[model samples]
Target: MAEVFIGSEEVAAGRVTRHELRRWYAPVYRGVYARKDIELSLRDRAIAAWLASGRKGVVAGVAASGLHGAPWVDPDVPIELVGVRIRPQHGLVPRADRIASDEITRVGGLPVTSRVRTAFDMGRHLERTDALVRLDALMWNQKFNRADVRALGDRYPRAAGLRRLLELLPLVDGGADSPRESRIRLWLLDAGLPQPETQIPVLATSTRPVAWLDMGWRDYKVAVEYDGDHHRKDRKQYVKDIARLRMLEALGWIVIRVIAEDKPSDVIARVEEALIRRGCSVEVDDLHRFARTFAA
Candidate 1:
C-alpha cells in the first residue's frame, strides 16, 4: 500500500477509497502515486515512471543500472524509459526509441534494459565523465561484454552520442572502485600519462595476494590511490592503511595517496614526479599543459 502504484488501479481494485487515496497518496507522475510521507528512492521513482507509462516502457539508463545493483548512482537522476512517449515530468524522462526484445529484461518485476543495453544507452546519452563513472560502476558490479555494447553501437550508428561513446569505450575500467578513482584515472590519461594498470596485485605468495594497488604502472612500482573520507574517519582502516603503506614502501612501491582536498593538478604533478623518480620518462611540458587545462 505504501509502494508506488497506479492510482486508478488501486481505487478500482477496492484497495482504497478515492477519498483515502487523495488523502494519503501523492502523485509521482500522471496517475502514479505513492504514500505522501514516503521518500522515493531511485527504484521507487523508476517504478513510478513505469506505472505512469502503463507498464509499456522499459526502464533504462542510470536508473536501469541502479536497479541492476550498480553502486554510486545519484538517486535524484531522472528515471528514463524506452519504447514509450510519456510526457516529460520532473523525475521521469520517456524515450520513444525502439528496443529489441532481447534487450529488455525484468528486474524486481519491472522491465528494464539489459546490462549491455543499459551501458549502450548510458554511453550514448550521458556526458563523457558521468558516463564513464556510471559505466565503471555498472561493469564493476556486473561483468558485461564490451563487444555487446559495441554491437549495439553498430546497430544504432546514427545515435546521438555515438562518437563520444566510441571515444569513451576504450577508457572504461571496472577496476575503478569509486567515481573519484575514475575521475583521477581520466585526468591522468588526459594529461598524457601512460595508461596505468588497475587492481595490481601485491603478491605475498605465488597463489596468495597480500593486497591490491588501486592503479599504477607495475613496471615502475608506482601506484596512485584515492582515499575517501572513510579511509581517515574509520579508526581501524586508518591504522591498517598506515601499516599497509609501510609494507608497500618496504617492497619498493611508491604510492601517491590522494584525498578530497588535493587539487587535481597537484595530484597529477605528484604522480608525474613519482614516475620520473622511478625512471619512467614523461614530457614535462605536456604535463604542464595538462595542468593548465585540468578541470575537476
Candidate 2:
C-alpha cells in the first residue's frame, strides 16, 4: 500500500495536523505513522521502525529471517533493529553489535541483515530445532548452503555462537518442506539412524517416476512422511495421499507416517523397527545420543 512516514514528514508535506495524525494515521512507533486503512506486514512494520529510528536501523534476528523469505516465524515477534547502542522498546529488539557493511542488504527498500548473517544469528539466538527449521527454509528459498555459513563464521571469528552454528551446519538440509519435516529429519539423525535422502523419487517398472518419498532409504525402500494439518483437512489431499501410499506399498516399500501428535521417542521406535524389519542394523547407543533434547 502506502508508504508510512514520520510525523515530521507529514507535517512538512502540509497536508495534516496532529489531530489528523492521531485520527487518520495509526502510530507504528512513537512518531512514525502508517495510514489507518493499510494492513502492516512484518516488512511494513520494519520500515516504520527504521523510519522512526531516523533511517538508521538495520533489521536483524527473526525479523531478518522473515526478510530472507523463511516462513513460520511468529508474526507478532518484535521487529529487531541494530545500528548504534540502543535499548529495547515496545515492538522492537535493538542491539549495538558490530555489523559489517556487507552484512546489510535490502528487501523492498527496507534494510535487513544478509541471509548468511541472518541465519548465523538465528542459530545463536533460537533453539536448535527452531534454528534448523529456519535454516532449512532459508536454504530452500535462497539456494544458500552450509559453505556460506562457514564463510561468515570465518569472517567473524570472535562472534558468538560459532560453535552452535557448527553443530547445526551438519543438520541443515534444503530438502525439508516444512518445520515438522525438518524436526523429523533431525530427530532421526540425533538417534543415529542412517541418513535418509530427502524427496527421493520412486521409480516405476518403466524406470519413470511414480512418486517422491519425503525421506527415504533406497536400500530398504522405506519412506518417512510427515502429514501436516492440511493433509487431514483437505479431502482431495487425503484421497491423493491414500493413492500414493498404496502405490508405494505395491512397489514393496514400507511407508512410515509421522504427525504432529507423535512423540519423538515413539517416532524413533517406529522407524527403527521398520529398518530392522528390512534387515538393516541400527546402533543401540546412537538412539540415546539425542535423548537429552527431549528430556524437558
Candidate 3:
C-alpha cells in the first residue's frame, strides 16, 4: 500500500508477502511501513505513530494541530499521543495525561484530540514561545472559544502547567500570519506597550480593503511588520510591497519594518519610537528591562 500500514498485518492478511514488504516498503516505526517511493507528510507520520500504538493512542499536541489543518507545522516534529503506554521510539511521544472522551475526535478514521483540547495540551506542554506560535497557527485554522480551553483547565485544576496556560490564554490571537509576527507581538507586549491589533485593515477609496498591517495600534497609526526572506526573494512581491508601503505612508501610517537580521531591541525601539511619535506613551524603563531580557 502507498499509505502507512502495519507490515505484519498486511502479511498475515495475504495483502503482501514479507519479502515484498521488505523490498517495496520502508519501516517508519517498529512495525509500520510505507511505500518507499511515496513521501510521508506529518499526517502520514501521525498515522504511523498510531499504528505503532496498535491504534490505541489518540494523537495530540502539534500533531493534532497539524491534522486539524493548521499551517507551519514542522513535518519532522515527533508525533505526540495520549491514551497509550507504548515505549518511546524515534518519532513518537506517548503521554499519560488525563484525556476525556469529549476531548478526542476522529479525523480520517484516526482518533485525534479536538481543537480545544489540542490547544490546551500544547499551551501547557510546549515552551512558552513555541506554545504561542502553535496556538496562533491552530486558532488561525480553526475558530475555537478560549473559554472552552479555560473550562478544561478548570476541570483539571492541578494539571501540570495550568498556571502557565492561564497566563498564555490572553495572548493567544488567531490573526497572526506567521510565527515571526507572533514573536514580534509578544515582544511589544512584554515591553509594556499596548497590545497591538493584528491584521489591521487599511481601506482604499472604495469599501474594499487595500492592505492589512501585520500588527499595529489603529488609534496611533503605527504598525510593526516582520519581513521574511520571501518578500525580497520574490521580485513581484518585492515590487508590490514597495508600492504598499508608499500607500500606507501616504495614509499617515508609521510602519516599522523588521527583517531577520534586525536585533530584537532595535525592532522594539523602532516600534516604540513610532508609537510615541504617533502620540502613544510607553514606559521607557519597563521597555529597557524587556529589551535587556530579550537580548540575554
Candidate 4:
C-alpha cells in the first residue's frame, strides 16, 4: 500500500498548488491528505492522525488494537491518540495523558500502543461487552499472553478504568476466535452455565483432530457455536460447516448454533435443553436467573 503523504510534503516537492490540493486530495486530517480514490482504511486513518499530531503521538484504544492485528475494530472508529497534546478532530480523539515509553511501539512505521498496553487500555476504558470483544480479538490475533496485561495494569495504579480492567482480566480467554464468540461465552457464564472451553479439538479414533468446537463441555459432549453471516454467504465455508456439524452429531455430540437474530434468552434455552439431553441436571432456578440477567 502506498503511504498517505502529508500535504506539506507535496507542497515542498512543488508538485501541487493550493487549489490542486484542495480539489484533488481528500483531507483525512487537518493538514494531511490522501489520494481521492484511495480508500480510507483503519491503517490509513491512523497514519493521518499521526501526521496531524506532527508525527509525535502514539495510537491507542481501538485504533491501536487494529494496528496490533485485532480484526474486529471498525475502520471508521475514531482514531485515538495518546501523548498527542492536540485538540480532537471530527474523527480523531487525542489524549494528552502520560504514556510511558515502554507502553508504545511502532507498527508499519506508525507509533501505536504496545500489544499489552492496547489490550489493557481497551479493557479499562470501554464498556464491558465492547472491552471483552476487543481484548478477545487482540488475544486471538496476536496470541498475546494474559499475564502481560496483568503486569502492565500495575504500572497504571490510579488509571481511570482500573477497576473494570481488573474485573475483566480474569475473563480474558485467548481461545475465542471472534467478538460474537466472546459475547456468547459471557452470556453463557452470566446465565450460570458451566464455563465452556473454547476452540476444543474433536479427535476421532485416528491421531489427527477432525474438527474444533467453538465452545463445548467435554464431560457432556455438548458444543455451542455462533455462526455469523459469512458462514452462510461463503459457499465453501457453509459446506464445510455442514459437514463438520454432521460429523460431530454422528460422534454423539449435541451442537447449539447461534446467529445474528437469535435472542439471548432463546440461546440460553437451547443450550439448557442440550445440556439436559446430555444427562446433565440443570437447575430451573438458575435458568430463571439467566433470564433475569438478560432482561437486566
Give the lowest summed-lDDT range of ten residues in model 1.
287-296
User: For each candidate, what TM-score against the reference?
Assistant: 0.93, 0.91, 0.94, 0.89
Q: Which runs in model 4 stand beyond 4 Å of their true positions?
A: 1-3, 233-243, 276-291
TM-score of 2: 0.91
- Write the residue-wise lDDT of candidate 1 on 155-208 in tens digits: 888888888988888898999988999989988877878899999999764777
| Candidates by TM-score, descending order | 3, 1, 2, 4
Which segments of model 2 are wrong by more than 4 Å?
Answer: 73-75, 286-296
Give one clash count per candidate, in the order shown: 0, 0, 0, 0
Q: Rank the candidates by lDDT, best first.
A: 3, 1, 4, 2
Candidate 2 lDDT, 1-296, residue by residue in tens:
24678887778788688888888888888788888887878888888778777788899888888878777767667888877555567998776667888989988788899888788787876788888888888877766667877888888788777788889987787888888999899888878788888889888887778888889799998899999989989999999999999989999999999888888888888899999999989875744665725723
| Alpha-carbon local distance difference test for all models | 0.89, 0.83, 0.89, 0.85
* Tens-place lDDT digits, model 4, residues 1-296: 24576887788888777788888888888888888977788998998898899989899999998888888788999988998699888999987567888888999888899998888888888998889888888888877777888887677687888788888877788888888899888887767677789998999999788988899899999999989999999999999999988999999899998997888878887898899888888655666594546643
Residue 278, model 2: lDDT of: 98
Relative to the unseen true structure, what is the C-alpha lDDT of residue 270 in candidate 4, on a scale of 0 to 100?
Answer: 86
In terms of lDDT, the best-performing candidate is 3
Better of 3 and 4 by TM-score: 3
Model 2, residue 211: displacement in angstroms?
Answer: 1.0
Which candidate tops TM-score?
Answer: 3
Where does model 3 exceed 4 Å of error?
284-291
Give lDDT tens digits, candidate 3, residues 1-296.
Answer: 54999998899999999999989899999999999998889989999999999889999999999999999998878999999899998989999898999999999888999999999999999998889999999989978899999999989998899898889999999999999888888777777788989999898698888899998999999988888999999999999989999999999898899998887777777887888888887875765685658652
